[model samples]
Target: SLALGPSGAWSRCAPAAATRRRSDSDAVGRQAGMFPETMSVFGNRWAAALLVAAFLETTRFTDFQTQLGAPPSLLAERLQTFCAIGVLSSSPAERSGSERSTYLLTDKGRALFPVLVAALQWAQQWFRAPEGPAIALTHRGCGAGFTGELACDRCTELLAGAQISVVAR
Candidate 1:
C-alpha cells in the first residue's frame, strides 16, 4: 500500500516494504519521482485551471481570477510558481507603463498538451455531463470537433493502458 509518510513523502508501506524503516535517501527518492511531482502540480485545482486557461488563450491576471474564482493571493502564488518552473512566461501587456502582464505558456508548458488531452478524454469518458460539456474543442486542421487519441510515436498505433509500460531510466 502506498501512503504519505509523516514527513510528507509518499512511501510504499505495505508488506515487506513496510517492515523495514525508510532511510533518508529513500525518503528523498520518494519525493523525486517525476510522476508524483507532476501530480502535485496538477492536483492543485488553481494551477491546473491556470494552465488550461493559458492554453485557451486567457492571459491576464484578472482573467485567471475570474475564470477560476481563485483569490488574488492564491492566484499570485500559483502564477509565481509556474513562472519559476519555466512553465509560463510573463510579459508586459503594453509598452505604456502598466501593472498588467500577459501570461503565456512556455514551450515546456506546451509540451504538456498530451497529458492534458489524455485527462480530458478520461474525464469525458467517466464524468457525467447532464448539461453537456462545458467546453467543446474544434480542430483547425481537421475542420471538425476534436477527440484526442494516444498513439505510439514510432508505429503510430493507438495506445491504451495495457499497451504501456513504465521503465526507469
Candidate 2:
C-alpha cells in the first residue's frame, strides 16, 4: 500500500494496481446506470465540482474548491479521481507564476456535459426551484430557448419517458 503522507488514511493511498481495478469497475458501473457506486470515489461534492469546473474557461484545483465550496484536500482528492477516470485532463500551467495545475475537459468529459444538462433539466421540471437555472441554453439557428425534450426522429413527436425501454443484460 502506498502511503499518503502521515495521515494514515487507508483509502487515501490505495495500491496502484488496486486503483486501476477500481477505475475499471467504476467505468462499468457508470455504463450500467449504477453511478452511485462509481461516484463513491469522488462523491456528490466532487461531481458537483466537476460540473462547475466545466462552466469555467480554466479549471484549477483552487477554482474547483471555490466553486464547489469544498475543502482543499477534498477538492484535490476529487480532481485526482476525475483525472484517473479519463474525464478530465490535467497539465502543469505553461506560464510562470502559476503554482497550481490547470484542468481541461477531455472529449469524453464534453460528451458527459449533455447528460448533466439533461439531468438538471429533469430536476428543474420535477423539483422545486428556489432560483432559476444559472445559464440558459439557446439554439443558434433559431435564437430560441432549447427545450430539453427528446423527440422521436421518425415521428417528430415528443417521446414519452415510458416509451423508451432498456434491455439490461
Candidate 3:
C-alpha cells in the first residue's frame, strides 16, 4: 500500500499479510534457517549467470569469464564455490602441459537443468522483457515445447504452492 506522508511524498507500506506468519509451526522460520546453506550454493550474486552459462556449454575458465563479462576474481570465487560443493568437476585443459583447467558440470550441476528452465519460464511469464527472452528450450527427443510445470508423478497433474503439504518425514 502507498500512503501520503505529511510532506506529500508517497511512502510504501507493507501489507499486513507480509508481517504475519502463515502458521504457528514456524514453517517459514524453519525454511529461513536452511536458506544460508542453500544460498551458499545457489544465492551468490552471479550464481544464476554463471550456472546458466555453464548449462549452455561454457567450459573453460576464460570462456566463462568472457561470456559472463564478470571479473576474473569473482568468477574464480564462484567456480571455487561450485568445486567445493561437488557441483562441477575441473580438469587441466592441457593434460600434460597447459596451465589452464576446464570445468565440467557434474551430475549434481546437470540436475539444475530443469531449475534453469523453470526460472526462465517464470521470468518470461511474470516479467516483461523489452527484447523478449534470450533463448528458448525445446525437448530434443520429440521437439515439444516446455511448459515448466512441476507435475506430480502420482496424478500427473501440475502442482502449485497451495497444492503442497509438508510433513516432518
Candidate 4:
C-alpha cells in the first residue's frame, strides 16, 4: 500500500521485504499488473482526446479526425486498437447508405466516464486556467455545474486520499 504524505507525494506504507532482490522475473511480474497496461492505453498524446470524443458521441471517422486534428494513420490505428480491446464497436454508417463506418463506445468504454471526469477535475485543480476552465460541465439531472466526487460504492460515503489504500495481492 501507499500513503499520500503532507507534501502530496505517495510513499509505500508497507514494509519492504529485507531479503528480496531485483530480478528479471520481478520486472515481468510488474508488467503483468493492470496499472501499467491501463497507462499504456492513455499514454499517447491523442488517446484521451479520442476517447473523450467518442464519449461525446462523435462517431464518424472524418469527424474524429477533424475534431482532433490527428494524423489519419494514427487515428485509424487508435480506433482499431479500441475495437480490438472491446472498448468500441464499429458499424456501417446509417446515412444514405454511405460506405463509411461509425464507432460507438461499448459498456467497457462507458465504464471510463467517471475516470475521465476525475481526470478533468484533477486538471482543473493542478493546471492553470487563466481564462477559466477549457470545458465547463453541467449535470443534466441537477441542472448545476458538475464537480466530480469520489465516494464509496458500498457505504455511499465520500472518500479522500488518506481513506484510500492500494493493496497488492
Best by TM-score: 4
For candidate 4, give the lDDT: 0.66
> Which 10 consecutive residues of model 1 have the lowest summed lDDT?
9-18
Q: What is the TM-score of each candidate against the true structure?
A: 0.75, 0.65, 0.74, 0.76
When sorted by TM-score, best at the front, the candidate numbers are: 4, 1, 3, 2
lDDT of 4 by residue, 12-33 (tens): 1111232222222223235666
Tens digit of per-residue lDDT, candidate 1, span 1-169: 1111132111111111212132122232357566644654575545555676777787899987776666677677667767756688999887688979989989999998877767755765676355454445567777777778889999999998899998967
Error of 2 at 154 (Å): 6.7
Clash count for candidate 3 is 0
Against the unseen true structure, what C-alpha lDDT does each candidate score?
A: 0.63, 0.55, 0.64, 0.66
User: Where in model 1 is the C-alpha error above 4 Å?
Assistant: 1-37
Check candidate 2 and list the clashing pairs: none
Tell me which of candidates 1 and 4 scores higher on lDDT.
Answer: 4
lDDT for each residue of candidate 2 in 1-169, tens digit (9 for 90 to 100): 1111233222221221212222233353355445654464345434643553454444777665554455565456566766766677898988888776988878867766656667656744665334544445656677777757778889988888799888978
Best by lDDT: 4
Model 3 has an lDDT value of 0.64
| TM-score of model number 3 | 0.74
